[model samples]
Structures are given as structure tokens and as C-alpha cells.
Target: MASIALVDDDRNILTSVSIALKSEGFTVRVYSDGETALKALAENPPDLAVLDIKMPRMDGMELLRRLRERTAVPVIFLTSKDDELDEALGLAMGADDYITKPFSQRLLIARIRAILRRTEARAEPEAPDEAQPAAEPIVRGRLSMDPARHRVSWNGQDVVLTVTEFLLLEVLAQRPGFVKTRDQLMDTAYQDDVYVDDRTIDSHIKRLRRKFRAVDPEFKAIETLYGVGYRFAEE
Candidate 1:
């Protein structure tokens, strides 16, 4: 049974979601605030986290920012229907996905299962050492991406990326100079069968650039094509 941490101030939400997840055979752990959730997570991480954006002391965004520093555990944000900016910002800050308030329990379950499936798929064991070359690292002008290891580096300096960011960057860097439409990226990067808007893709791209730029201030490997989409700069 996979363990899930649910963080939200609303007792009603906690009770409802916890019951639903438990019925699905998930070990549900509920926290009423981000501070408690964060402390518990650092001590023993869960398979997935569902966080509400409006928590006091430490909001979902802040908890995510701090959590990413310690673990790459997948996260899903909960936000109000009108919190468009918060949703985009949460994605930029490395959240895997977000669901607006008044969301259906069925939709939430589907999303959770999708993310879990992806996570499990990614963790599958690798082939024998002799067959390793088949999954070689992707190299592009000082940027290296190892899909087999799920690692990325710029100028030989290691950089951390969330699972979604890693998938998005891998898709672009593997096909340097090829423009990937927002829809294409959505299909490829977010394989959970969810419909994420173009703005979500934009936020992810912006954060991707920021991560690489931190290692190399002259990082220009990712380029935007104005009204079109984005591409990885060819060497």
C-alpha cells in the first residue's frame, strides 16, 4: 500500500479525502497545516503529497520549495478556482500537478493513480551492464541528460530537476533545435492523461532555464519561438 500525505487546514477536506484514499487501499496520513506536514515529511517521506496552497505559516508553495531541497517526492497542489497565478507559480516552483478547489473525488483519484503509475514506471530496474549503452546519456553543448539515471548536468555541474521538469527537458534536448508545441509537451511530459494549459508549459520552461542558468549564467540552450513554442538550441 502506497503512503500518501494530505495537508489541508479544512477538517472536512481532510476527513473526506482521507476516507476516499483509504478505501482505495492507500495508507493516508493527514496533516492540518504545512508546518506539521513539512516536519513529518523530512523525517519520513511519503510516496506522494497533496497540499493546499492557503495553509498558514507555511503555504503549499513554501513547503514545496523546501521539500524539493530534500527529496524529489511527487507533489500535487490544491488551489482555488480563481488562483490561476498560484497554480502557475506552483508549477514553476516544481510541483508535479495541481487540482482546483471543488474538484471531484473521482478526478482526484485518477490523477493520483496516474502520477503513481508514472513514478513506478520510472523506478523500474535497469537492464544488464552490457546493454547499458542502449540508454546512453543525451549530450547537447555542455548539457548532459541521463535518462537511465534521471539526472541532468550543465557544464559538468549537477543540477536538480523535478520529475516533470526532467521529462520536459529530456524531450527538448534529445531533439535539439526542434520546436515542440505546447500540446506535444503536455502529452509527453505529463503522461497522466490530464489537460494542462500552455501557460503551465511556459511556467515549466521558465523554471528549466532558471535551473540551467544557475550553473552557467550564459545558458541559452533553451529558446522560445514567440507565438509558436520552444526548442533546445542546437550546438
Candidate 2:
């Protein structure tokens, strides 16, 4: 079972998230503060981390920034507010993905498993005698992306990502100007049989854009389609 850390200041949120992750067969560890969680990571890093945006001792964003400097482990933020600005900031700071308040357990499980699946897929060994490409070795100005190796590099440097993040980029790249509804992404990428809401797709995409934008200041590659869904790299 993959080990996952859950960091939330609220006891209820911690317990609920822990139970949800454990039910999915993950080895779950709960920390009520950023300080404790950070220390635990220093000693024994979990395969993935699910953090709350607001926590005592150190906020989620600060902890995430420090964590990125030391590890590329995936991080999923839990935020009560649904502000675009906060989502952008968290992603820019290196968060892999997130779940807003009132999200369902099923959706959370889907995100966790999807990320793990993608991470494992990307780590697969190369064919005998075939050399594996370096990480994020491709770029396309503000819209850098990779299809073969499952990575994306904005501008010139690598932007840390989880498996889900890379696949989301892939789906967007397949149709640059056309709108991709949330349902389309779910039908194409979300393997969970359960019908997860479109907001889940939106949430992950929001986080993905933040990280890309941090690397490219003019980044607006993933564009919203108002009442519909989203488009990518509009020509």
C-alpha cells in the first residue's frame, strides 16, 4: 500500500480525510499542524501528501515551498475557500493538486489513485538498450509540454508535477483551441467508474496552471470557457 500523509489543523477534517484515504487502502498518517507534518516528512517521507491550506505553526503554502526544495513528492492541498487567487498561488508554489471544502470522499479517492497511477506509469523502466529521456526536456514558449516522457517544462526549467498533472496537460494538448468539458476529461482520464463532478476537473486544472505560470509569468495557456469548460493554447 502507498503511504500518504494527511495534514490538517481541524481534527474533524484530519479524521475524515484519514478515513477516506485508509478506506482506499493507503497507509495514512495524520498531522494536525504544519510543523509536525514537516518534521515527519523529514524523517520518513510519505509517497504523497494531502495538506490543508490553513494550519497552525506553518501554513500549507509555506510548508509546501520548503518541501519542494527537498523533495518532488506529490502534494494535494485542501482549501476551504475557492478563490482563483489562492488556487493560483498554491499551484505556483508547487502543489500537485487540491480539493475544495465539501468535496466528496469518492472524488478524493479518485484523485489519490489517479495521481498514484500516473506517478507509477511515468516511473516505468525503458525498453532494453533504449535510454530514458531527461525530465521535462521539451518546451514551447509559454505552453511547454511533453507527450513521450510524460513531463512539462515551462520556459526553460522543470515544473514539478504529479501523474495527474501530466495527463491533464496531455488531454489539453490534444485539442489546443477546442473546449474540453469537465465531463470529457473524466471520460478520457478519470478511471473511476463513479461519475465525478466537473468541479474536480476544474480544481485539478486550476492547480496545474499555477505551477506552469510560476515558471512562465505570462502563462495563460489553459483558458476558461465561461459557462462551458476550458480550452488550451488558443491559436
Candidate 3:
């Protein structure tokens, strides 16, 4: 059973979501504020976390920023229905996903399951194949990706990425210099049934670039073409 931590200031949301997640067989932990969640999470990290953007003391954004410094636990932000900026900022700050307020419980559950599935798949070890050789790590310029290990490095420095970001980078780097439309990248990163806006993909790409740049200040492997798509530079 996957464990989930939910941090929100709303009592009703915490209670309702806890019950819903428990009914679905998830081990649920609830925190009424981000500060409490941050401390507990550092001591005992959950499989995934659902965080609300607004709260007393430390808000979700600060909590996420602090968490990203220590862990890569998948995070899904809960924002107000009209808070598009929050959603985008959360994604750019390393959140794996986000859902607006007044969202369907069913939709939230589906999103959680989808993210868990991706993380779980990445954690599982690949079985050896006698007839086929092991897949080689993809190396393009200063970037290197080991798909089986879910590891990425740039110029010998490790770069951590969420499952969504990793999938997007893989798809683009696999065909360097070939522009992949936003739709194509979305289809690759998200489940077929799950729907995400163009901005979501753009935010993830922005985060991806930021992560790579952290390791290499001169990183310019990811190129964006306005109004068209993005491509990995052929080096």
C-alpha cells in the first residue's frame, strides 16, 4: 500500500480527502499546516504528497521549495480554482502535478494513481534479457541518461528530475534536433487518459531546464522554438 501525506489548512478538505484515500487502500497522513508536514516528512517521507497552496506559517510553495532541497518525493499541489499562476509556479518548483480547488474526488484519485504508477515503474528493476543486450545510457553532448536506473547527469554532475520531467527529457533527447510538439510531449509524460494543459507541459520543461542549469550554468541543450515545439540540440 502506498503512503500519502496531505497538507492543507482546510479541515473539511483534510478529513474528506483522508477518508477518500483510505477507502482506496492508501495509507494517509494529514497535516493542517505546511510547517508540521515539512518536519514530519523529513523524518518519514511518504510515497507521495498532496499539498494545498495556502496555509498558516509556511505555505505550500515554501514547503515544496524546502522539500526539493532534500527529497524528490512526488508532490501534487492543490490550488484555488482560478489560481493558474500558482499551478504553474508549483510545477516549475518541482511539483509532479497539481489540481485546482473544487476538483472532483475521483479526478484527484486518478491523478494520484497515475503518478504512483509512474514512480513505482521507475523503481522496479528491469529483468535481464539473454537474447537482447542491456539498453545503453543515452548520451547527448553533456547530458547522460540511464533509463533503467532513472538517473540523469550533465557534465558529470547529477541532475534530479521528477518522473514527468524525466519522461519529457527522454522523449526529446531520444531524437535530438527533432522538434516534438507540446501534444507529443504531453502524451509521452502523462497517462493516455489523463489530461493536462499546454502550460503544464511548458512548466515541466521550464523546471527541467532549471534543474540542468543548476549543475551547468551554461547548459543550453534544450532549445525552445516559439509557436512550434522544443528540441534537444544535436551536439
What does each candidate score in C-alpha RMSD?
Answer: 5.2, 4.3, 5.3
**lDDT score for residue 114 of model 3:** 75
Residue 4 CA displacement from its true place in model 1, Å: 1.5
Estimate the lDDT of model 2.
Answer: 0.77
Instruction: Report residue 59 deviation for candidate 3 (angstroms).
Output: 7.4
* Whole-model lDDT per candidate: 0.84, 0.77, 0.86
Least accurate 10 contiguous residues by lDDT in model 2: 134-143
lDDT of 3 at 219: 84
Ranking 1 against 2 by lDDT, winner: 1
- Ranked by lDDT from best down, the candidates are 3, 1, 2
* Residue-level error in angstroms, candidate 3, position 49: 3.2
For residue 20, give model 3's deviation from the true position in Å: 6.2
User: Which stretches of candidate 3 lie above 4 Å from their native place?
Assistant: 1-3, 15-29, 33-46, 51-111, 122-136
In each prediction, how many residue pairs overlap at the backbone (N, C-alpha, C within less than 3 A)? Answer: 0, 0, 0
lDDT digits (tens) for residues 1-235 of candidate 1: 8999999999999999999999989999999999999989988999999999998889999999999999998899999985758866887687877887898775577678867876786776767874334367899989988876667888889887756778789889888989998898888765546566898789879878877887888999889999889899998
Candidate 3 lDDT over 1-235, as tens digits, reads: 9999999999999999999999989999999999999999988999999999999999999999999988899999999975757866886688887777787676688778878886786676766763445457899988899976777899898886656678899999999999999999878876636677888789778878877887788888899999998999998
| lDDT (Cα, tens digit) per residue for candidate 2, span 54-168 | 8778999999998887888888888876666666678778776777787777767787887777677677888868866645433434456665455567656777665566777
Model 1, residue 71: displacement in angstroms? 9.3
